[model samples]
Target: MGLEFNDETFRGDYTFRNSAKAIARFPFPFAEDSYMYSVNMEPHLPGRPGSVFEHMFDVDEHYVAEMRDRAQVLAEDPLRCQSLPHMTLAGWDLLELIMESKARDYPQWFSLTKDGNRWHWINRPLQIEQSFTFLDETTLPYGPMEYITRQTQGDFTLQDQRDDNLWIEAGMVTTQADWSLDFDIGMSFHEWHAPVPLAHEMRVFDRALKFLLNLQLGAPVRRFNWTMTVDPLLDTSPENYPKWGPSKTTMTPETIGHRQHLRVELQTLHRLPRSNAIVFPIRCYLIKFEELVTVPKWARRLHRVVRDIPDELATYKGFIRNKPLMLDYLSKYDDGAPTSPGIWPE
Candidate 1:
């Protein structure tokens, strides 16, 4: 049997303490590698996507015999070719002050901060949790390859190491007889809005509201969360595994892609008086869970967010020549595919 679970829940947590100067990191869930791309869009020289892990895999030879020195990485494809302006990530977003911090320019470029006029960022926190049951391991790995789970479902609470933020991720197997739950909680503190993309300071809540609500897809289907509340000890001191600092990981670019859908709901408060206010809409996926990673290599053009699809998305005139998002890119005429059902080939 593959990885099978009857239930699933995904949550996306985000905090924008600083909009500019902050950074964004994209990491693979299981792979201990990442393509640390910058959010500033300040024009990086160009960096190889899969280099660090490659070097790490050969650490024994490089560390002593060959040895990886600073000069070695600097001369590489990604590091040398890409000219990225230095930007520090994971620092300075104060704490829960997400909206207030976003209200102004953050990480205020080196030039501005050097002038001695410092801007304020709350040092926000973000967390994303993915838990579900898998039935088979055809194309995907049978078990988690790298980001192994030690324990889950009990007292689940993680702290914001870099700052005051705290996050907890957990899961459990509730059964009809011996129902034991599994909890996987990861906690860390980092700065948001430190990057420039969101720093565009796109100040229009309505659009964000639409995306969160999935407003265009029709009415929403609310879910009733069934979770256990447990209090886990605040672990600040680090010994080794799961603790912050230099970690030996297998995360790579290939691991992070093709993730499942997500959902989130947050209640926020504003300045002066910590008063009750609007509840930010949660991001939910209309696509079923099983369909998330099942993509067709033949069809690349239609693999985009549904919102970006133009009127052409409604009709499918060909099959093998031009594939559909699913079997039915156009949503009409069944392409008469025995192997695939919802295809679009008139």
Candidate 2:
């Protein structure tokens, strides 16, 4: 059977939610009871049948709703999606990659037919159908990267590699975690990541840059990045901080379970075949504290990770103000029972 897309909102009335299946497949970021900065990358290999890692791009029930949210974000601010003139070819490369991957993996919902660059694409879930000449920008309404990423979940940044560094030349970043694409548009790998705490001191980005500089085609890599969001607001960019920042001060122990959300980003990097650029897709997933605690193991480990996390890291994640409150709610689930090692619930 085909997946049933959720009809929900990520902002304002905040109707976003996780079904039993979503919670079960949630990519709980921590594999241990602690967290720190590290280059914890792994081969983008397929995993257990029902897990999120099972596909190149995992499409969940939130697909259509997330697209709706992306459109809303872009409508409000077109700067959320931008591409340098030179990066247009990279955008086409990205479009081809996502279309092919989704069409192959979720054939029921997406399909692509190609006849020597004359392509027909259909996205049943979003009710989108387009026949555009591949690499021909005039055939599509938007740039290539913006076109496909609009239909696909996640925020994508196309990096141009030169002088042994990756340049963030183009991207569609509406669902970022407190970062602004407009500000970081032309920065290098290190420059854009400089604001992240301790990672540079630990030489995490140094080593990561070295590894990605040598990334091979058809051999993508992925890693998990996580942070805390007070609500299920996806457009948590710095531009809109004033609107969502005040949310942190409103959380109480009584409401934290429902209002607090664990935001996990399943970030994958692929070497585009044509432009020789790296396409970094940051796919964000959110599960409320009440829903997360449904899994006893995740509950116990999360409590320890948050409680014992370094104050600096907590502050950087924007949850230090409510750490005590989160601990109070998560503590009830820890129970001091030893959680089995590894991310899976035993």
Best-fitting candidate, scored by lDDT: 2
Cα lDDT of candidate 2 equals 0.94
lDDT (CA) per prediction: 0.19, 0.94
Candidate 1's TM-score reads 0.19
lDDT of model 2 at position 2: 54
TM-score of each: 0.19, 0.99
lDDT of 2 at 327: 91
lDDT of 1 by residue, 1-346 (tens): 1111222121121111111111011111111111111221111112233321111010111111111111232233221111111100110111122223222322221011111322322211112123322212232221221111111111111112212232222211111011111211232112221221231244433333333332221122221111101010111112211431221132223322222111111111111112111111111112221232233311221233222323332221111122232323322222323222221211
Indicate the TM-score of model 2: 0.99
| Candidate 2 local lDDT, 7-40, one digit each (tens) | 9999989999999999999999999999988899
Question: Could you list the CA RMSD of all candidates, in the order they appear?
Answer: 23.7, 0.7
Error of 1 at 11 (Å): 14
Residue 203 miss distance in model 1 (angstroms): 4.5
> How many clashing pairs per prediction, in order?
49, 0
